[model samples]
Target: MIDLIALRRRLHRHPELALHLPETRETLLEAISSLGLRVETSTSSSSLAVVVPGAGPGPTVLLRADMDGLPVTEESGVGFSSSNGNMHACGHDLHMAALVGAVHELTRRREEFEGDVLAIFQPGEEGAGGAELMIAEKVLLTTGRKPLASFGVHVLSFAEAGMFYCREGAVMGATINFELKVLGRGGHAARPHTALDPISTAALIVQGIQTFVAQNSSPADPIVITVGSLRAGTAANVIPNTALLKVSLRATSSQTARDAYRKIAGLGAAIAEAYGLRMTSEVGPDLGPTVSDKEGVELVRQTVGDLYGAGRYKELTVPEMISEDFSLFLEETGGAFVLVGAAVDGTPHQLPTNHSSEARFDDSVVPEIANLLAELAIRRLNIASETNRWA
Candidate 1:
């Protein structure tokens, strides 16, 4: 068996970012090569799919783990912190290690089950649309046997470590990236009336944008619009020609997401027009929402409960506002993306959350997720076989 803790630490030390993770790819390739699974690298992106066959023919199941790191510099204070100015603040390193552990456990017990397990190591999930590219390249269909179900696990920073938390529908919200350029006439700062200040216009738009979700959308449906970045004049003396705003929109449903985007864009345009400036707004690709199918959720709930006892599993009453690209898998093949809590030392308040430079993940949850993924695949395989037999 691979030394999971050691492997995770190694990955954590040397983090890679986005779709072009050559080093991460090589590391993952070496880890899975000895297992004798049929592995293929994606021609379009830095991703690979490995097929592990069982003792006999049955439905196929896909287990996925994203392999990408954030661009944030490490302040996590771990001995294994990355020195290259990149950190796995979101715990993708742990995801990779846990999936590898699952591969180790499932391949050893292949004789106990009868199906193929396609383990997908995906990169560029942070914002590069890795899932969409893989889908276009047919990552799901490459296993030869059509996958009856798919399963994926993500680590959350605040939830209790070694526990699983998720909801059945819309567990994660959809993400939309928007850039707004507020253009205005540049003039001397001394002549206040002469300058059409875009910086002032952008400030107003930023403060007013949040009201779109609160006033326009229903309270029952959740939406979040955040202005992550704002930049204007470099010097205090001159009014800049343009101001820029980079914002993110997350919503539980597509309609809510779209509606929020429209309202915000319209508001920005109006603000610019009133200031005698031109505002151009463009929205990026939608990172689809991760929603769990009913059957898949029940299967996971039962499997985790059985393995770690009922207390280890809990479903959230409301979906989380954060977004995930795993939504593509659920949209295509109908599956569940389970959220396993990995708060550092099981105390969320003490440590930073995911995407934080100081964010730290508990390694103890690594094997727990591994066990959950393995058991989920086995149980789903049996359930698929029984359903096929009846049909």
Candidate 2:
């Protein structure tokens, strides 16, 4: 009896961002307040860990939904579009609503399943490492037992509506953020010989990144590097004392990610040292490249095939460049991240991508999404316990 469309539209109208989503958290808490499920909130973040105990105790299963909005202005022009300056332009509003529906479905079928469901509403999924923050608080073991496996689904506004896509391992790319600062003596632009030009040194570092990757990495391996931000020099004629450059790297494997980072950092230092300047580099934690467990993925395939037809489940031959903190969850428990298509209106394979101001999703698939999530949890519990996953 839950009106998922209405709920999603309501959330879509008012979007919040990052770990400190008080309004979004309150809205979610109130929506499920009358459900009588056991709920717990995080001390470090505005995350919710809800448990729906079954008729009998066996094992626990983890299901997650991200709960943050991007910093995009509303332009999708939906009737319930957000006007709060923050937008769920990434389809997280649908994700939250679908998970809520899943909780409701699992509660109604509590007697049919014999294990607990741990529903995680995570914040700061955009880039703030909220998943890592929540996991630090030990919410993963909230059922007093390790979950057999975990599963999460994403709504892709650009993909075909109602279809599910997945891959067995490393379905998404692992990401690393590298920032380099070149320190040198500042001087007028006309006096280039008098000053160690950090700007030129930074440019050399960027060029070296491309050449190093091309020389070292295989073409088939898939490595991506983007210069996110570069800032140097204040005035037109004056050279700044330091030049700062931020680079983002994404790769399919951990070894490749590490190799790329090391080279980039080393390249900056090597170029600076040659220019008689010192370069400082900051390397962030290599966050993702969400790996799907073989068994976990099969569970999704079977569940999706049974719920929908076999044609609904699309296998991914190649991994995606997109990264998610959901990888942090998969690190603790085996899981697969599945993408559900939710295009509002578009031809097949052509639609606006998520994170854009024009992104739109079909909330009518909310029921189907809730059912898939509920089934994954139930099936994981049944199979893991039968195979002695904990023992």
Alpha-carbon local distance difference test for all models:
0.87, 0.87
Sum up the clashes in candidate 1. Answer: 0
Q: Worst ten-residue run, lDDT, model 2?
A: 382-391
Question: How does model 2 fare in lDDT?
Answer: 0.87
Q: Give the runs in model 1 whose Cα sits over 4 Å from its true position.
A: 346-350, 389-391
Q: Judging by TM-score against the true structure, name the best candidate.
A: 1
Every model's TM-score: 0.96, 0.91
- Candidate 2 matches the true fold with a TM-score of 0.91
Kindly give the stretch of ten consecutive residues in candidate 1 with the minimal lDDT sum: 382-391
Count of clashing residue pairs in every prediction: 0, 0
Error of 2 at 341 (Å): 2.0
| Model 1 agreement with the true structure over 100-174: per-residue lDDT tens digits | 999989999899788788899999899888988888888888867667788998888878887787778988888
